[model samples]
Target chain A: MKAVYKRELNSYLNNPMGYVFLGIFVLFFSVIFCYINLYSLVSSNISYTFSYMIYAMLVLMPLLTMRLMSEEKAQKTDQLLLTAPVKASSIILGKFFAAMTLVLLALVFTLPHIVILVIQGNPGFLVTLLAYIGFILYSSVYVSIGIFISSLTENQVISAVLTFAIFMGLLALEILFVPGIQSPTLYKILSGISFASRYSDFSMGVFNLTSLVYYASAAFLFLFFTVRVTEKRRWA
Target chain B: MIEISNLTKSFGKHKVLDNITFRVGEGEVLGFLGANGAGKSTTMNIITGYLSSNEGKVLINGINILEEPEKAKKLIGYLPEQPPLYLNMTVSEYLDFVYQLKGIKLNEKAEKGEKSEKQQHIEEICEMCGITGVYKRLIGNLSKGYRQRVGLAQALIGNPEVLILDEPTVGLDPVQIIEIRNLIRELGKKHTVILSSHILSEVSAICEKVIIIHNGRIAAASVTDKLIKEFQDSNRLRLTAEGDAQELVKTVSVIYGVDSVEIDETKTNSSAAEIIIRTSKDVRGPIMSRLVEKNIGVINFGLDTVSLEDIFLKYVGGESDEGSIQERAE
Candidate 1:
């Protein structure tokens, strides 16, 4: 697991991928941070930054996870991993955490926003901390979804596009439930399943255990599916 | 040691491996000979735990590969037809990754002795595979031969008891092919190696035991030389003499115990003619006297054995849609 993790992490860092992801993420994050906090002078609430970061992740996380499994399959390097002594689940988790680490690294680069908020204005530390936790958990669900999509195909472009499409649907789930589709029960059930809905509690300064469980279970569910897909592909 | 028993596999309706059974003992070099799409790669994949068979089991040293994959996989190293490599990584990094993937603790090995045993083992493998010079370079920049060496090095990293190399010399030039063949020969001294190739001479040169697969079934399996002798052509003798080609052919055609006679165009020219006599008996003395009595100047003569190419073509039946003997006749 460590071998896979280190190799995957190095692949991101050793190439332009890590830098490109970080650069684009920080640029977008700063633009949003400046427009919301500096320009609007709404420095009291930092949750807006966390909420926008989730949107940023809907695009960027796919980029990080798209090539994770698909590239390995295309290059036939999956043979090495599949035949290695490690369990298939461990390989999946190792790659999962490697992509998560990049997300964390990109988040780390956005740490200056917190510093600037702390220095320049009245910042809500507790809310900011909770929102950061919320952002990690929320982004993990998408990251897992991305990794799962990557495992479904050997084409990286297809993986990326499918992940983006699924994430767009999930991000728009709340709006999807807005109109009258004549199914209230279905709306309530789907709204409950909406990952974006569960995340709203965290950014609103409420640490609901149900929301936490929802996001955690969503991440676990996707990761479980990813492992199953990979295992099934070996037979295939 | 590896044993595959009644192994069967299929991709949906297309059966890839059909009730194949074979075994390789410790320190035995087994060669798998097959044409393209003959289930060679599929069988190797199943043995190495890369793919699961539909209705069979592969055992490595008596440990079932599917049931105890990690334990069995630890005992084997595999190199697929294409060398699986991360082009972005340097050779040292990729090898280190593979070494760790094999579950060898480098720190523990380092703690065991003065210097790092992990590094030492990797260096030794590099030296053996002749890739020491390219250890620091990225795999993408290296030539195909070096990439192949890196793949070989990856397989050699854990020093697994068995090595499964699928068409190890498929795309290499003649010189590179010979080099990899020598390396496999050297590796066979300590490891139980199973390699697949379409080239018959390669198998005859390096493998002690050869198994030929045709259309998802084992067409033949035996000692390499024994297989050669079993399907070998009829014995023949060739005599070069300074005589008329037609006269030489007609003279040898009437000899008793001689099956047939034909002028050896390869050896015949204006100054001399060569006639090959197919026979099951030793008529060398009679033939020599007959040539001398005819006043024909004899240059050289010798008996020829069947080449492995003939045996392979006979067994594989070439690409012709006919019986093996009919194909051989063609």
Candidate 2:
């Protein structure tokens, strides 16, 4: 697992994909931070920045995870991994953690904004910490989902497009369905399952255990599915 | 140290391998000979634990591949038809990654006085595969032959006991093919080697035993020299003499042990005629003396050695619809 992780991380760092992902993410992150907090609202509430960053993730997270597994398949390099004395789960987790490490690095780039907020005006430290935690958990779910989609196809473009479409579908469910539902029971269920709604608590300075478990389990479920997909392809 | 028993595999509705079984003893070089799409790659994949078989088990040093893949796979090395290389990585980095991936552990106490064990091991493999000069270069920048050598180097890492190579010399030039064949032969001295190739001469050149696969079934299997000898029981001789075509055929047909004699119409002319004689025994002495006695000037007379191509065709040509065999023969 460590070997695969090191190789994957080195691959990402050696290629242009990692730079492009980090560049696009930091570019959008700064633009959203400047426009939402510094220029227009002049508010020190960093939670709003974290809240708006989800939109950027919908477009950029696929960049990090699209080629994770699909490139291995397309290049026929998976044969080396599969035939090695390693488990399929180890390969999946190695790639997953590598991508997550890059995501964490991108998140680290956002720390300057928090520093600027602290220097320019008073900002709640606990709320900012909670927002960072929320973003990591939120990105975990999408990263796992993107990796699951990647394992399904050998084409990187197809993997990216499918992951983007699924992210859009989930976003549409949160924005269009939860508020527009007529029945209270239906609204309760939809809101319970909605990723954005669960994230709203974190953005509002509330550490919701249910939302935490929801994201954690969702990420685990998708990673488990990715492992199963790889194993099934061997049998196939 | 490899045993495969009753292995069967199918891809959906189409069966790819049917009840195939073979074994390779320690330090033996075995060749899997077959045409394209003959389930050679499928069988190798199953043995390496890269693919699962439908109804069989592969035992690597007595450990079932499917039941204990990690332990079994640790004892084997595989090189697929297309070498699985990361183009973005240099040869050194790629080899290091594989060294780690294979989880090879060396005795630290023995190697403490010398260069690190991993470095020495990798260096030896690089030298053996002749890729030491390109160690620092990216795999993408290397030539095809270098890439192939690098692939072979990776397979040699950790000094696995069994090495399974799928068409190791495919797409190489004649010189490179011979070089790789020699390398495989050298490696076969200490490792159990199983290589697949459709070329007849390659099997005869490197492998001691040959298993001919046709349409997912074992068509024939035997020691390479014995197999060729088995098919050479009947003698064939081509005779060229300066005589009338009809006179040449009639003179050779009457000799003892000569089953039949036919005039080669293509090469036959008014001056010299070519005749092919098939016999169950050597009749060169009688045919020669009789031809000399008949005042026919003997131009060429020798035993026609039956090549492995004939044996391979005799097995696979019976039911194949492919025209490649005929084209190759011509």
Candidate 3:
């Protein structure tokens, strides 16, 4: 697992994709940060910056995870991993953590905004920490879904497009279904399962345990599916 | 060092391997001879634990591959038809990654040596595979031969007891083919080797034992020389002479000990005719004397040695009739 992790991380660091991802992430983040805090002067809460960043993540996270498994399959390098004396779960987790590490590094680049806020105006430390945690958890779910889609096909473009489509669907579930459902009970269920509604609590400075478990379990379920997909390919 | 029993595999409704069984002893070089899509790679994949068999088990050095893949896989190394290489990585980095991925560990006592044991081990493998000069270069920049050598180097890491190579010399030039064949021969002295190829001379040159697979079945299996000898029992003689083609066949068919006589259409023309005679005994002197009496000048005459190509065709091109083939083998 450690060997796979190191190789995957180095693959990202050696290529231009890692820097490209960081560049786009920081670029959009700065734009959002400026408009939310500097232009409007709406509030001193940093969580507002994170809330808007989730929309940017819908397009950016796929860049990091699209080639994670699909490239291995397209290049026939998966034979090396599958034939090695390692478990399938270990290979999946190794790639998952590597992408997550890059996302965390991108999140670290946002710390300067918090510092600038502290210098000029008062900001709540606990609220900022909770918001960062919420972003990390949300990104984990996105990364897992991206990787799971990657394992399904060998074409990186298809993997990226499908992942982006799924993220968009998950984010707009309530809005897409609001007009179709007439019953109040069915409407409640649709909004309840929506990722946007669950994430709204975190952006509002509320540490909701149910939302935490929902995100963690959603991430775990996709990772488990990735493992099963790799194992099933052997039989195929 | 390896045993496979009653292996069967199917892709959807089409069966690829059917009740195949074979074994390789310690330090033996076995060759799998088959045409394209004859299930050669499938068998190798199953032995290396890369693919699962529907109704069979592979045991590598007494460890079941399906039941204990980690332990069984640790004892064997596999090189697929396409070498699984990361083009973005340098040769040294790729080897180091494979070394760690295989979970090879040096002795605790060797940890206190002058240089790190892992580095020394990888360097030694590179030297053996003749890739030391390109160690720092990226795999993408290397030539095809160098890429193949790097692939071979990765398979040699940890010095596994058994090596399974699927067409190791495919797409190489003649010189490179010979070089890789010599390398496999050298490695076979220390490890049990199983290699697959559709090239007849390659199996006859390197492998001690050969198994010919045709249409997902074991067509024949025996020691290489013994298999060739078994099919070469009936002697064939090629006689080239300046005579009428029809009259030559008529005269040769009546000779004693000659089972049949056929005009070699490819080498025969109006002036000189080449006749192939299948005989159970030496009739060279009788044929020359008879032809001299008929005023026909003998241009060339020699015994034609039956090559592995003939045997391969006899087994693969014939009908799917195992009973006749078995009787001929006996």
Candidate 4:
């Protein structure tokens, strides 16, 4: 596991895709940070930045996770991992952590925004910490989904496009809103599945345990599916 | 030691391996010879625990691969047909990844109690494989032969007891082919090596035993020399007579052991022509005496033994029936 993690992490750090992801992430984040805090000085909150960054994540997560498993398959390098003494679960988790580490690295670069807010308007550090934590959890779910999609195909473009389509559909659930349903039970279920609704509590300074658990569960479910998909491919 | 019993595998409805079974003893080099799409790689994949067999058990030194893959896989090092390399990594980094994947360092910490020793051991392997000079070069930049050596070095990591190589010398030059064959021979002294190749001479040159797979079935499996002997055509004797070749062949065909006779018109030297006689047993005494009785002076005489090329073509060309899969009765 340690070996796979180091190799995968180095691949990202030493390759061009890692810098591209960071560039796009930093550029969009700066644009959002400027519009929210610099252009509109009325708001001193940094959580608003986290809220808008989720939109940036929809684009960034696919780039981070698209090649994670698909490249291994396309290059036939998975034979090394699969035939090694290590289990399939370890390989999947190693890749998951490697990709998550890069996403967190990109998140760490956004710390200046919080520092600027703290210096000028004195935003509470605890609220900022909770919002960042919430954002990490939310991004992890998407990372898991992206990797899961990567395992289904050997083509990186197909993996990226599929991940983008799925994430966009999820994002649309929040942006476009669900069609009006006559039943309150169906309405509650639809709203319950909306990531935007759950993340709204964190952006509004309300620390919601249910939303945290829901995000964790979703991440676990996607990771589980990824492992299963990889294992099933052996038989295939 | 490896034992595969009644293995069967299928991709959907298409069977890739059908009841195939074979074994390699410890420290023996077993060569798998087959045509393209003849289930050689599929069998290797199943034995390496990379693919699951639909039916049967693969036991590695008594431990079942399917039941305990982690433990079984620890004993086997596999080099697939393509080498399975990461192009972005340097040769050293690639080997480090393989070493880690094999978990040899962790095992060394528990079993050997030394870190410097492991480094030295890895360096020695690189030197042995002749890749020490390219250690820092990226695998992508290396030539095909270097890439193959890197692949070999990766498989040598962890000092596995069994090495499974699929077409290990397929793309190498003649010099590299001989070098790799010599290396495989050297490795066979301490490891059980199962290599698959379509090259007949490569197998006959290195392998102690050979398995010929055809159409998802084991068409023939025996000691290399024994298979060659089994496929030997009827004993053939070539003799150049100083007299009429046609009269000598007619006289040789009358012998008790002789089955048929043919005169080589192209091999005539002056008036003497080469006569090829097919017989069931050694007919040299009878043919010589008969020639003496007929006053046909023999210029040269020799027994022609069957070459491995004949045996390989006989099996791979599907001329030998499937019933020949039964072990030869010495």
Candidate 5:
């Protein structure tokens, strides 16, 4: 398992995919920081930068997850992993972690914003930290989304489009969770499923256990589902 | 050692493989021979734990691939129909990644101030595959033959007890084919090798036991010599001589064990004829002495040859409508 993880991580580094993803990601944060943090005379709410950073991930997460499994299936390279002396969970987790690491690498670039705020003026330390947690949670869901869509097709373009559609749908589901609907009980249940509710809670510095469990379990459920999908393919 | 028993695989309503069984002993070379789409790839996939067979099992050294895939897989290395490689990585990096994926706990094997043992293994594999010169080059930039060599090198790494290669030399040049064949022959001394190819000549030349598959069924399986002798044209003797070709033909007919005779149509002369003697017996010894006493000018002689290609075509190609008609009548 360590062997697969090491190799997967190094391939991402050597392939320059890590660089491209990090480059575009840092560029998003910088552009946001310049407009919100640099141009503005008053700099109190720097944590809001991450809310804008969500748009960056809307484009970057698809790029990160697009080639993850689809390329392996396309090149037949998955055979190596499938035939290797390792558990299937290890291979899937190894990929998920590598992609998560790339997103985390992008998340770290926002740290300098907090540092600049500390030097120039006082900012809420807890809110900025909450935003980082939210960033990781949201990207984790995206990783799972990317992997599930990737397993469905061999074409990278199709995988990317499908992942984007899934992310957009999940985002829209959060907005349309009207309390006036038939049953308020079902509305609460449906709202918990939305990634927006999960991330918004974290970004607001309220670490609700339901939101935490929802985000973590949603990622786990999707990863487990992706594994089952790929495993089922061998028979189909 | 590898054992495949009663292996049956079906794709929905289409039965692609039907109760196929074979075994490979250590230090032996086994070849799977068939026409295109003979389920060769499917069989390899099942054995390597890449695909699950619906009604069969593959055991590698007593470990069932389905039940304990990781343990069974550790005993085998498989090169599928296409070399599974990350085109983005260099040759060395790709091998390193493969080595790492195999999980070598070699902290003790690493030397100080040098690359890890994984890197060393990758370098050695690159050297063995003759890709040392291009070790730093991306796999995408390499030619087809180089890609194949890289695939073989991956299979050879970790020194597994069994190597399963599907059409390893499919699109290679003659020299590359011979080189890959020689490598397999060398690897045969220490490991069990099972390679599949539609080309009958390669299987005949490189393998000891040949399994000919047709329509997803085992059509023929035996030693090469036995198969040829059992199916192809009957053995015949050839003798070229200068004489009255008609009388030469008639005289040889009277000899015991002589099945048939024919005179060469490209005549040497009108008065004296050049002839070919065909006999059931490979009797060049007694026939040559008798012919020498008759003053017949002895020229050339040998036994008729049957290539594996001939047998392969007859087996798989027999699925044609005309053959089915003939089979129905029989």
Candidate 6:
């Protein structure tokens, strides 16, 4: 796990893709930060920072996660990782944790906006912390989904395009569910499924355990599916 | 020791390895020979735990690969047809990472690991594979032979007991082929090395025992010398003589120690003929004397010996059967 983690992290940092992802993410965040905190007069709420992140992440998450498995498959490097003396779960988690760490680092860099809020106004840090947790959880879900989608194909372009489509569908699951469903019960269950619905409560200063469980477990499902997908390809 | 019993792999209904069985003793070099698409790589992949066999068992040093893959994989190191390298990394970077992947510790001792002796082993493998000069270079920049060595070096890390390499010498120049063969030979003294190749001479030169696979089944399995001996008579000769072909044939057929003779007039010049001699055992000396005494002046005589190529062709055929997967279920 340590070796996989170290190597993956190093590859990201050493390769140009790392810089591209970090730059795109930071650049977009800074633009939103200036608009939300500086240009606006009453800049007390740091939670608005997250609203900007969603739009950014719709583009940003795929950048980091699209190549996660697709590139490995393309390069035939997955053969090394899969054939090593490591369990399937360890491999899945190792990759998950490494990509999560990168996303966390980028999220951590968003701290300055919150620090300014605290310095200028006595804003609730709890709400801000909850919002940040929501950010990580939400991005992790996308990362796993992207990884799962990446595993389904060898071509990076196809992986990237299909991942975008799947993500758009996840983002719009609510709209698709309506008029088709006749029950309020089904509506609530699926409303609980979207990243926007699950994350909205957290961004509103509420950290719900149900939402937390939903995101974590969904991530696990994707990881599990990713393993099965990879294993299936070996036989195919 | 490596044992593969009743091993079979299939993609859907297509069987790639069909009930193949073989055993390699410790420190033995086993050469896997087949024509292209003969399922050599498929068998190797299953043994290395890279691909699961639809049915069968692979045991390395007494541990089953399927039941306990992690522990079993620890005992074996593999270099696939492609090196499975991260070309973005330097050779040292790739190996250090491989060493760590096998759970070899890099720093302070864990409860149990190979961290203490890790660097020396890495360096030693680097030297053994002749990649020391290119250790600092990115793997992508190295030549095909160097990339192959790096892959070999990765397989050698952590002192694995069994090494499975597929077409290990595929892209090498003649000199590099000899070097890699020598290295494999030297390693065979300590490790059970199993490699596959389509080149017959390479197998004849390196292997003690050879398994010839054709159409996903074992066509022949024997010691290399016996396979050659069965087909080639070492002291046999073919001669063209200035005489009636049938008369020459009748004379040579009666000679002592002459095993069998075939006379052909179609390929002969006027007043001459060609006769192929097969001694019951290697008896070229007696056969030649008898032929000369017949006064059928020997036009030309040349000794013939069956080569590995002939045996391989006879078994695998000139063009290997175009094999395919039947998409069998697991």
- Kept native contacts, as fractions per model, are 0.90, 0.82, 0.72, 0.87, 0.90, 0.84
What lDDT score goes with residue B23 in model 1?
92
lDDT of 4 by residue, A138-211 (tens): 98899999999999999999999999999999888656766566688887898898887888888778889999
TM-score of chain B of 4: 0.83
lDDT score at residue B201, model 4, on the 0-100 scale? 91
Give candidate 4's whole-model lDDT.
0.87
At residue B194, candidate 1 shows an lDDT of 99
lDDT of each: 0.86, 0.90, 0.89, 0.87, 0.80, 0.82
Say what the interface RMSD of candidate 5 is: 1.3
Best by DockQ: 1
| DockQ scores of all models, one per candidate | 0.87, 0.86, 0.73, 0.86, 0.69, 0.76
Instruction: List model 5 lDDT by residue over A1-236, tens digit each.
Output: 56655666776788677788899988988888878777863665565677777767877888888887888899999898898888778788888998887777777776777778888887787777777777788789889889888988999999999888877776666666454567878887787566776677776677777776777888999899888987887787
Identify the CAPRI category of the predicted complex in candidate 4.
high
Tell me, what's the RMSD of every candidate?
Answer: 3.4, 3.1, 4.5, 4.7, 4.1, 3.9
lDDT of 4 by residue, B105-173 (tens): 533443456456667778888988889999999999999988888888999998999999999997788
TM-score of chain B of each: 0.88, 0.90, 0.88, 0.83, 0.83, 0.84
Give the number of colliding residue pairs in candidate 1.
Answer: 0
Q: Write the per-residue lDDT of candidate 3 for residues B1-105, one digit (tens) a residue.
A: 899999999988777899999999999999999877788999998998889999988999989998898999899888988899999999989998998899899
**Where does the lowest 10-residue lDDT sum fall in candidate 3 chain B?**
B319-328
- Ordered from best to worst lDDT, the candidate numbers read 2, 3, 4, 1, 6, 5
Model 6 Cα RMSD, 1 decimal: 3.9
Error of 6 at A225 (Å): 2.0
Q: Candidate 5 on B188-256: residue-level lDDT in tens?
A: 888899999977888888888899987678988898778888765445655566667776777667777
Sorted on TM-score, best first, the list reads: 2, 1, 3, 4, 6, 5
Please, what is the TM-score per model? Answer: 0.93, 0.94, 0.91, 0.91, 0.88, 0.90
Question: Which stretches of candidate 5 lie above 4 Å from their native place?
Answer: A15-17, A34-43, A176-183, B107-123, B229-235, B238-256, B262-282, B285-300, B317-330
- CAPRI-style quality class for the chain A–B interface of candidate 1: high
